[model samples]
Target: MFTRFSPYWLWGLLSIFPIFWTYLVLASSNPSIVHILVHPSGEWAARLLIFTLMITPLSMFFKNSALVRWMRRNRRYFGVASFAYAAMHTVFYVADKGSLAQVLDELPRLYILTGWLAFAIFVPLAATSVDFAVRKMGRHWKALQRWVYVSAVLTLVHWASLNDWNSPLGAVVHFTPLVVLEGYRIRHHFAMRMKRTA
Candidate 1:
């Protein structure tokens, strides 16, 4: 059975795993599990971002955007998944501390405000991810989604704030790859534009 058709089962399974796992872990955890669960959410966000970034490079290498059709189809879903994690992380912070006002008051101290802001940006982007919203926003939808870039940066900041030593070496390691990926994307776009002009 495994030899018969691997592609259909493999990619399809991997793509949907995040969604299933998110809900599954959320439901299965005990009351003390809130912290552990939030960790997965942050990690999931990073994983989803990396997955989305991989799409273009994979398409380029394969010489076929069709290879990444499933990724394109589920980009919004992974994005929303990331937002779900971030939101849950926020909820944990608020709930554990007890009181929205206290959380808001201490927000600056924990630097959770950065995470809050990043999640806030994700809200509208996720809300308007559908075709109807794109049509309604006209050309503005793309610009609005550009907030993801800002959200990504803020996410790194939020992660950095959680560090005890402010070293954030791991965050730098995570972010540097994305910086390189974006650089490649920019260069690729420019080269394409130049080729078109030529």
Candidate 2:
């Protein structure tokens, strides 16, 4: 079944879930609409970002795995989707804040500042997630994309510090796998370099 259709088509199909979720959120008559939208959108953004980052290490570890191969091909989609959800999350937050002065007033808070920093990093990365940018930037493209690591760390800090660091378990749980995989990727890279030198 998977072989019959292009990956883009599969991605399109998968995209319906987020589209539907957004529709549901927007259509709801809930009084706390901003509150309702913020957390879920942020979670989706983080999940997709993690999935995008996971592909490289998974590909390295499971060179022959079809799933990893598929993920590699669709990695850009995951990244763009993450940015889209992050955009939504930011929009909802701004709407919740109600005014520029109010928003600026909260900018000094650690959680808010980190969240904005992560979103700021995401903008350039998302803008350059294209064939033209890849060709034009050449080696520099990868260097720019590497900033996602910094964005991920900021995102972790943002999530964990919410409510004065009162409920960090969710953020810790979500990010643990990413931390472990990245650690392994670094170790594997050093090990390979050592082998080459040996």
- Candidate closest to the true structure, highest lDDT: 2
Q: Please list the residue runs of candidate 1 whose C-alpha ends up more than 4 Å from where it truly belongs after superposition.
A: 1-31, 164-167, 192-198
Worst 10 residues of 1 by lDDT: 1-10
lDDT of 1 by residue, 50-71 (tens): 5665566556556545546655
Candidate 2 has what TM-score?
A: 0.93
Candidate 2 on 1-198: residue-level lDDT in tens? 334558678678657756776677678878687777788889889988988899998888899888788778788988998998899889889987889999999999999999999999999999999999999999999999999999999999999999999999999999999899999999989999999999
Collision count of model 2: 0
C-alpha lDDT of all candidate models, in order? 0.69, 0.89
Error of 2 at 54 (Å): 0.6
Off by over 4 Å in 2: 1-3
Give per-model CA RMSD.
4.5, 1.6
Q: Largest TM-score belongs to which candidate?
A: 2
